[model samples]
Target: MTDQTAPTDPAEVTAHLDARLDDDARAWFAESRDRIGDDPAAVRVLFPAVSRRVGRGPLAPGGDGDDPFVWHRDDAGRALLLAAVDPGARPGELRDCYTHGDARERRGVLRSLEVVEVDDEVTAELVDDALRTNDVRLVAAALGPAGVAVLDDDGFAQAVLKAVFVDLDLERIAGIPDRVTPELSRMMADFVHERVAAGRAVPASVWTVIDRHPPADRLAAIEAERDHEDPHRAAAAAAALDARP
Candidate 1:
């Protein structure tokens, strides 16, 4: 996946992946990249071979802070593979790649959306398909920056609600701050209400989204969170209330 450091720019990502590879793997990667460029159909074969060819370790190691995008070595390889495809054929290839490939391959296609050029409708369909699945990893991959860029307001809010339904960490869905809407706040509040009524614990991460788009007239649910037994939820509610206009 793309990050602030790499931003999914194919050239930058290639360089990042190249620097981490040993001499032999690096050579293989370069050859594969060019081979896919020459014969776009070859990507079907090379796409799944990335993890074996390049290590599966994080391309950039995480540290103590808000987690940056952690691209596995194979993820970068796959993105580069997509980038190597002829732009005219890339959309069809991407759709096939997502359809035929297993979960990880599908995730790679979703995460690599920004790096490869394609029709918005094509990416939208892929994102929609991923969001419909019960697979948590695939769902999370679909809500990432690439997916975020393509989803409209209602679709995005529903996706966030879907994350809650499947118990995904809201933090994993990047670009939430910029994408938040009152509809999202309402949906999150409804979720909070259901959980509270059922005596189920609310995910603390949901509060982050609520705080971001705190509905002007519906502060009660969020305000009530101020005294939540979980200190994290309590603090998030306190912040949301204190910041309320």
Candidate 2:
């Protein structure tokens, strides 16, 4: 996502999104939204055409903070806005949207899972499906608040590790600080060792996970980085050590 400041208000963001659309796109969005109730397959038709109608630029910008739609492209964000207000967007229909979508459409569906009506099993399935992909965008979207709500602890940890594997920043994984486990700590520690053994720089996110769950043995490893050349890594290590009780 680009570095533009995100508009935190949902209503404001929606207004901004609508403002960006030209007359034809706005009319199409309204008509498609109306079609959701009368036509069962409306989303299937409308979802893919979003980019052509809405444009592919970043909808707002910056990463998801208070505003989840911030990171989405205009089309994806527009799709999400449609899904948000549509009462017909049930789990089965949403699942079909994901199943039939291209990566961008799938991302809109995945991020919408948290707000839409979906059972735990379907949520896990969608999240796992996205996690299994090599697409960093899909992987990142999968680990959103919906993933955190539905994934088991083990599954969540593995997803976080997957984000690290795909070079996504740890901050992008929603609620990760509250979700870390000893297993995740160990997994990240092992990753750090492997990178060091291979003469490679560890992914900066590896420290975020490890530092949050600082086991005694892992503290030494984290402490060792306190003097590392990268200021970010050094600060992370020092913060972890300083937090020791």
Candidate 3:
């Protein structure tokens, strides 16, 4: 809502929603484009309460749920807001929208992250906030191209770990394979070891960063798992070993 100077691209929203949603659903997106002016505050004011509790599961558009359908509404609202408040649409406003809005609203803000440009610090803060939550949608949104680019290395590591901790899709995150750091690699190695101890399946994708020159002991542990009964664990172990020299 803060004085928006940047132009919001409705196309950005359409690009994400058009192909995925039905034409009936897509029409509203195009319709919502003109619903706002230079000030996007009015719509946010009437959005679902930040404190409202929406139960789990999918929702119909404008329906009584908090999933994708509800998310669509929130996305449309944000797109409209962005359209009206471009030129200076800051991340602080985004953070505020995500914080003050309900589950779907938070998702919408995260969805809008790519289109709305702000300072790196603000991006880091918003991405951190999203990762801190366990909501799969919000986390997915935070890992978008812009979001990942804005994150500091430490913040990036935390986001990656948090994603794994929640068992979300790493495929949704941008700049993964190329962004790995030794610190992140070490953290992933420890996570792998912990999951093994707990008898939980370490997400196979964790190996993307985990295979980076593990210590001798860790390598030995991975080698030991190669013949374990759990084929997945064994495959993961083998993959880890193969990923290295």
Candidate 4:
């Protein structure tokens, strides 16, 4: 919608989206025809349009309610993010877009990884590269949507740990349940210990990772946190008690 050379076929671009979209999303897209456009295949055009039309507050279908994780939802945003991908674009192009692009562009590429063919080493390296950055937005995008499912065990684990390190809202991360592991709990437990010992405030979301049947010590640590002054931390501790091993 924003670009002149928009894709010639919206049908083709949206063909793979059936499973990814729901009834509400379909209706939204239908009404969004003027913004989404009748012709569309490339992500370059769709991305800007979504940004312009969606206005980045809440996600579509749900309009991003009060949930902090809403950034990863909106079907329009998802479709637009995928538009940056040419499908035929090579790894080199994808790499350039990521390495040279601004934050919005980088996010588009990260979101497109699900549909793009990133079999080559360069593209595959992008995931790790983004994870290593302290840029919280990049980290969030890298771990959003298909990322959690696609990243290797260690990569995904690192992403989660990094989110905590950067003080990112864990809800922004998709597939947190599947990605959680005992080793991650240990890492988080260690982090919580260090932070608490230093008189630094620990994010309550850390308990989200630790709540998944963590070891006894970790469970005890979270349970003790139930008395924390911050309602978020106290709430996390309370919830973890029921879910803990």
Please tell me which predicted candidate would have the highest TM-score against the true structure: 1
Write down the TM-score of every candidate.
0.83, 0.78, 0.69, 0.60
lDDT, residue 138, model 2: 78
When 1 and 4 are scored with lDDT, the better candidate is 1
**Model 3 clashes, total count:** 8
Candidate 3 structure, TM-score to reference: 0.69
Estimate the TM-score for candidate 2: 0.78
Best by lDDT: 1
Residue lDDT tens for model 2, 131-195? 99988877877776766778888888888888877788776577767788888888887776555
Answer with 3 or 4, whichever has the higher lDDT: 3
Q: Candidate 1's C-alpha lDDT?
A: 0.77
Instruction: Show where candidate 4 strays beyond 4 Å.
Output: 1-86, 115-117, 120-123, 218-245
Model 4, range 185-213, lDDT digits (tens) per residue?
78877777556544456666776777664
Model 2 CA lDDT for position 1: 21
User: Can you write out model 1's per-residue Cα lDDT over 18-131, one digit (the tens) per residue?
Assistant: 888999998998899889889989999889888888877777655222232445677778888999999988999989999999877887788688577888899999999999
Indicate the residue-level lDDT of 117 in model 1.
81
Clashing pairs in 4: 10-40, 42-83, 43-83, 43-84, 59-64
Model 1 misplacement above 4 A = 1-6, 62-69, 216-245
Q: lDDT by residue for model 3 over 31-127, one digit each (tens)?
A: 4444434454544553343122222222233343422213343454454455455445444456677678776777766656656556777767777
lDDT of 2 at 199: 40
